[model samples]
Target: MLKLLIAVIFFAILLSLAAGAGFLIRDQSPSTRLLTSLKTRILLTALLMVLLVYGFSQGALGT
Candidate 1:
């Protein structure tokens, strides 16, 4: 379950990255879509890091 959550968050980050790229290529004027995607990615990444640290501390990850 925890691993599944980690994978989901990781994939969400990837999706956000793709959205940012699409926004960069499709948007001509200054827009917030890219920025929003960036913020989402950053938050997801932070969540992932926190989950990883928690997993390691709980002996749920690593050897």
Candidate 2:
């Protein structure tokens, strides 16, 4: 379950990245969508890092 959550968050970050790229290509002028996407990706990445650390610390995830 925890692993699934991590994967979902990771995918969300990827999706945000793609969206940002699309926004960059579609919008010639300054846009808020790209900035929002970047912010979302950053937050999701931080969340993923925190979850990974907690999972490892609790022995819920490991090799």
Candidate 3:
């Protein structure tokens, strides 16, 4: 269940990144969209890292 939740969250973050990329390409001049996306991505990456670490420590992931 935890693994599934993690996977879902991870994919959602990836989709957000793709959307951000699309926005960056479509929008022109002084847009906060790109910066917002970058910050979101960074924060999501950190969360993912923490999830992985917790999963491993709990023996929910890895051999």
lDDT leader: 1
Instruction: Note the clash tally of each candidate.
Output: 0, 0, 0
Judge candidate 2 against the unseen true structure and give its global Cα lDDT, from 0 to 1.
Answer: 0.95
Local error of candidate 1 at residue 6 (angstroms): 0.3
Better of 1 and 2 by lDDT: 1
Candidate 2: misplaced stretches above 4 Å? Answer: none
Query: Which 10 residues in a row give candidate 1 its minimum summed lDDT?
Result: 30-39
Residue-wise lDDT of candidate 2 within 1-63, one digit each (tens)? 999999999999989999999999999887799999999999999999999999999999997
After best superposition, candidate 2 residue 3: deviation in angstroms? 0.4
Residue 41 in candidate 1, Cα distance off native in Å: 0.4
lDDT of 3 by residue, 1-63 (tens): 879878977997898799898988899988888888888888888888899999999999999
Each model's lDDT: 0.96, 0.95, 0.87
Write model 1 residue lDDT over 1-63, tens digit each, in one string: 889999999999999999999999999998899999999999999999999999999999889
- Model 2 reaches what TM-score against the true structure? 0.95
> TM-score for every candidate vs. truth?
0.97, 0.95, 0.87
Task: Give the range where candidate 2 is weakest over 10 consecutive residues by summed lDDT.
Answer: 28-37
Model 3 TM-score on a 0 to 1 scale: 0.87
Q: What is the lDDT of candidate 1?
A: 0.96
